[model samples]
Target: MNLSPLQAISPVDGRYRNTTQDLAQYFSEYGLIKYRVFVEIEYFIALCDINLPGLTAFDKANYNKLREVYLNFGETDAQEIKDTEKVTNHDVKAVEYFIKKKFDDLGFPDFKEFIHFGLTSQDINNTAIPYTFKLALNEVYYPKISSLIEKLKELATAWKDVPLLAHTHGQPASPTKLGKEFLVFAERLEIQLNSLKTIPNNAKFGGATGNFNAHHIAYPATNWVDFSNNFVNNTLGLNRAQHTTQIEHYDQFAAQCDALKRINNIIIDLDRDIWTYISKNYFKQKIKEGEVGSSAMPHKVNPIDFENAEGNAGLANALFEFFAAKLPISRLQRDLTDSTVLRNVGVPMAHTVISISSTLKGLNKILLNEEVITADLENNWAVVAEAIQTILRREAYPNPYEALKDLTRTNQKITADTMAVFIDGLKISAALKEELKQITPYNYTGVF
Candidate 1:
């Protein structure tokens, strides 16, 4: 079938295409070919700059022309490569042939042999994938998630003084500020983001194996190790693995997945909490005209955005866990497994982007029902037992814990009148009783 969003197989490309469209330039097959062409062209130009014997005659003026092959790479160019792949039966070799044809057209046919000289398919695949992956995270993922954190900060500051009854073990416990709860997520996201920054975008760039065997054999006197390091690290701006098999070790990539999984978990936690708050009537979502929350119930306005976020983030977390575990292992020298799995890197990322967008939407739609929150605090007056017990302990009252426990553990609800009557009957000074009476759920919120 001719592909449109509706006709696409995966929802990442179908139902949620708009949410993940930006990633097309980084993870799509066209994107992979474009990046391979870029690396090959840059490697050739770098060889020319180093005064490599065969490439010394390459014209410097045509460097921009070479760069344009990728900079202005179009669908036609990618299709041509794909057609070549059908004949060559090797994707990387097709990329090589396509670049060689571009060199011939650029009038540098003599220097075309230096295009993929002394490099393996892994060199191009590993370098190109990491290069684009880093760009995708920086350009797309970081900005979206950073905005979510900023939104949390905004909400936290706006509701900084709003009192919320804390729940422990599904029972009313101490009181907490609504804003402080929002701030907790922001703090967690920022810490994980910092850790994600520390991990290097690693790549493998040696020849066929971890060693520059071909390059060293061709130029025995030249330091090919330094050459590879400079090309992979300084030129391309990635970390070169000093040792590898036919492909990258992907250790740092696994670390990256683990870090992202933690981030997704935090987002899932926030989704569940916000969903609970909505269910408790502590948050009311702004209803849009003509929007249906439920088909049968007209008054229904579901917390669908948070629910969507929770589901997508959970799916992304599962994929991330698998990537972390699977990418680090290969049979002996190498296997085809990593290649197949690597193609789906965009799948989890697409889900993650969708979840982040959904969360931000859910947050924007929420309208806090402060009166409901306040009523909850007022109804849960027994939470003040802890404060009363602590104050009684300060006075060195005997059996203070047992005293408050006895008063609160009764079947009757602990309302303001109930506590007041109990305080009036206490065998303590009137001044101390008055001080204890001041403790209420609203004002008992601890310092953030």
Candidate 2:
């Protein structure tokens, strides 16, 4: 079968391919080959700049031409490298061989040997993956999520004065403003985004055993550690891990996953809250003409966007949990487990993108049902008991908490008249009774 979106197995590559196509340039097989080629070429160029013994004759003017090998890399080049990998059975080695062939075609056979000098498969794999991963986040993920945060801020600011009947333990409690509630999520997301910024995009660039053994053995006088650090950090814009066995230690990778999981959890929290709000009839969705809410029910308008966002966020978090717990561990120095697991990094990212998009869609669909909301506030007169009790306590009244609790905890439905009657019978003075009556659920919302 031709591998089109319809034929692909994973929904990310199939049903939702359009939602996550931006990630293809960072995590696809072709993307991996392209990055591997980039790292190999750049490493060779850096060596030329360093005056490595046999590389002094390399023409600096041809550097642009060398860079073009990867910068202008295309599908044909990627497929050729795949063909080479079929024979070598080593992906990174195949990338090196492909670069060597490019050098021969470019008429630089004398300099081709330095293309991947003194590097292991992990050196290339680790460096390329981290660099590409950072780009994907900075370019795609951050912008998408930040857009959601901005939308939330917009909602919060716009609805700041809209009173909300707050619920605690699924029962009416104190009242809060709608806008202030959204600010809660904006605050959480901002904190997580800051944490993500603190973590450096890290990679491992040492030779065989994280010691640069081959490079050191070849050039004892050279400062290989400083060289690798500068090349990985300054050149590639990633921090190089100083020590490892045969592969990147993956501690930072785990940290990245944990941070992202916390972010996804926050999004899930937002989804669930919005879903609940819609269920409670506090909000109505905009009618998209011809959109079906249910197969049979004509009056139904389901909160499917929030539901979709919640499900995808959950899926993303599960993979993130596995990544956080599993990637940092290796069976005595190295294992094949990380290799296979690492490839799926894009899967969680795709889900996250889809979830954020769903959330954005849901946010845009919301049309405040003020009639229903106002009716809820008007009906829940007992919610103002906390405000009345606090005022009575401020007036030095005795047993104020017990007074309001006894009035509110009854089986009888508390109305404005019921509260007024109860307050009139209170042991407090007339001024205090007047103050207690002033409290109403609609205006009793806490300061935003």
Where is the poorest 10-residue window by lDDT in model 2?
Answer: 427-436
- Top candidate on lDDT is 1
lDDT of 1 at 43: 93
Could you tell me which 10 consecutive residues in candidate 1 have the lowest summed lDDT? 50-59
| lDDT by residue (tens digit), candidate 1, 1-448 | 5689999989999999999999999999999999999999889988888888877777898899999999999989999999999999999999999998988888888888888999999999999999999999999999999999999999999999999999999999999999999999999999999999899999998888778888989888888878888988999999999999989999999999999999999999999999999999999999998899998998899999999999999899899999999999999978889998999888899999999999999999999999899999989899999999899899998888998899899999999989999888889999999999999998998987
Q: lDDT of each prediction vs. the true structure?
A: 0.93, 0.91
- Tens digit of lDDT per residue, candidate 2, span 158-260? 9999999999999987899999999999999999988997898889988878888899998999999999999999999999988888888888988998999
Give Cα distance to truth, residue 32, candidate 2, Å: 0.9
Pairs that collide in candidate 1 are none
Prediction-by-prediction clash tally? 0, 0
Listed in order, each prediction's TM-score against the native is 0.99, 0.98
Per-residue error for 146 in candidate 1, Å, reads 0.3
